[model samples]
Target: MFKKIVMFLYVMNLAFVGNAFAAGQDREDGLPGMPYRTPTDKEFRVCADPENLPYSNQKGEGFENKIAEVLAKDLGKELTYEFWLDRQGYLRNTINAQRCDVIIGMGSDVDTLRTSKPYYRSGYVFVYRKSSNYNIKDWNSEDLRKGIIGIVGESPPTIPLRDNDLMANARPYRLQRDLNLPPGHMIDDLVAGKIDVAIIWGPLGGYYAKKAKEPLVVVPLPEFKSERNSFDTLKGKAEFNISLAVRKKDKDRMEMIQGALDRNQSKILKILDDYGIPHVPVVLSDKIGN
Candidate 1:
């Protein structure tokens, strides 16, 4: 898939990852849960990617997990999850399958499932080892014209890479690969001096940029400083709104979940800060029909 962000966000329906729930619960049709309803018990059920760090993981170490914690505590509900490996068919298998009632870090724009008001927004970014002293601020910078650029192969970022004529030195990586394998393929290469900068999804880029063996610098593409829609030309490369997702027709639950998000926002923001998530808020274009 050339548009890897599509795979990461929409397809991230989730992977075979996360804490396991007991399989003995009774179901009307031998499924995980019923579709289109909130839990009757005191649980906030989440559909999660088991291995996506800085987001959700089995150990509950990721920021999304922290957000879930804030949510459960605020709503006076216990936290639980329906784990699914992030891959194609994830949506059909988890939330859509009614295995869980919510997806904690989904893009607000995902049309398959109903999404809450955006809790946060972020975009793709350029990450390079600071020791390399790369000073690129935008895709058109002359500083970027001379180095190896990394990206999820064939993604929307490639559109700008081509437009800016930076594809000559570009490197590509897979969007879907072995789950248990080592992570951070692009930033890993950047840190190893294999590439000058890696254009990656903002959250993972910011998290890994800080952890690179050498100090690393992260520059938000199009910079969330400008209009959040700066990359609209490339169709969703630069920024996107993130929120919780519930099955279609789940408006009642959506409002309840959105209320939790709206109330405990500060606590949720603190959790994102603790994980080094690059938080960007979305700005709408009511005039342009966004």
Candidate 2:
């Protein structure tokens, strides 16, 4: 009887030891200490617009497409895209729905969306017909005093033009349109001496003016400068910035993304410069608001 009791206690001890060991192993496997675990087959989803240019398109030819490509390469994941027309439905129907993990081409200062620190910078610009005598290199200078300045209706640029006393005396009119002409016909008119100067996004103005065979020059507007362009995620994901969105529970994935972003910052900036991404003015956000 004594021998049997001893044997039973020994077997019980062995079973307890085995169970403890198994539990420890399970804990380690579940939450292993590592930078970031290997991603599953389908990890990052790049959300983009099908028709937006210089930003993204279905054909994967825009700057955002190129950025997504580089990020995917670094993450060792296959890239996928959620293509949707850019509109109010973009965030609710697409990004927030998890159709895609990230949204590129978002404004850094947008209150509704959370964004990363400034990645690139450019500014709204003044484009003029080459023959126009007005040279508006500086928005504060008296140069703008000499001619009519055309601007798109209800744009960020309108704020500055209104606040500055420079255009105070001059009447502001909508960029005129002609019924008999196709779209961008006003640009043609500008080339043929119909309008003197216009304010526009630097990239579009520069590209289109050149495309239109109009000898035009570009000048950055002073007040509306420094709009930082960044990728956006839903609000409150500040710790896991949308610079690279991952599953909220995936801390490893977020760290890997941060690592990739840090490693590729220089290359990213170089690509942006080479392509003239025309980002919003980045450094001057605090002083200027619209």
Candidate 3:
């Protein structure tokens, strides 16, 4: 599950064709331009999945898109995107390839890229119809086992489900899929009565629950310890701090991006609220697990 989450953060592929920039120009600060560095002084180039929403998309309807707009405006730069599919080779082909300068949303703990201070924190959530009146507050609730629970295959929430002996009641969905298709199908199934409940990422759960035809309940899973013998000693943190990311060596660009985030913090928080994105107070840390 940990590996899958990390891969999801690291391997989003974007498919875009834009004018390539010249590399190796000397900067006014007298530092040599890093290879494949975009002209950051004039543009806020972002690498994003063109179809992943609640996060980003080609239509600029996602919260990440909205946040990117705020940052770009605050920085006085034109916002441009390198649209890609969120799949294996994403970081390799886009940001790592120097096709863009930043990824609007990335887990702060991702070691492969230099990440900015987290803007917000979020986690997995339990989504059920408000009509069900289940009031599920944690993984141990007996109501969870009494109904069909939809979960992303190998997601962190599955650990608790297994620990509570609820696997038999679970319906696992694909963790990765074709980017051309819209997301939030699990919530769709829950709304249609195909599943009684869904344990999904907080952002997806909150966004889709709000858009569902009937009212839905979204409950965040708090941090806990894993009970599986193999992972007994490990702490299972459902929540993760989210931040912008740049190439590992691009400290200057990262500082600039951080400045933009700091300046427009309120606007970004408003965007999250408007989208119904479930989040908690930011914890400025790069460590993923203890």
Candidate 1 colliding pairs: 2-154, 14-85, 14-86, 15-84, 15-85, 15-86, 16-85, 17-50, 18-50
Q: Report the C-alpha lDDT of model 2 over 1-290, residue by residue, as the tens digit.
A: 11001111111221101121121122212232323224356677777767555556789876678888887898888888878655433444454554665554443333233334445555556777767666677557566666666664434455556556545533343332222443344355567766667665554454456567757776665543322323122111101111333323445554565666677877776666655534443454321111
Native-referenced Cα lDDT, model 3: 0.72
Winning candidate number (TM-score): 3
Native-to-model Cα distance after best TM-score fit, residue 71 in candidate 1, in Å:
0.4
How well is each residue in 7-117 modelled by candidate 1, as lDDT tens digits? 233223222111111111212232454454456668888878787776778999878888888888988998998877666556666666667787787655545557777
Cα RMSD of predicted structure 1: 6.7
- Give the top-scoring candidate (lDDT): 3
Lowest summed-lDDT stretch of 10 residues in model 1?
16-25
Residue 211 error, candidate 3, Å: 0.9
Each candidate's clash count: 9, 3, 6
Query: For model 2, where is the 10-residue window of minimal lDDT?
Result: 1-10
The true-versus-predicted C-alpha distance at residue 190 of model 3, in Å, is 0.4
- Tell me the lDDT of candidate 1: 0.66
Candidate 2 or 1, higher TM-score: 1
Global CA lDDT of candidate 2, please?
A: 0.49
Task: For each candidate in the order shown, give its overall lDDT on alpha carbons.
Answer: 0.66, 0.49, 0.72
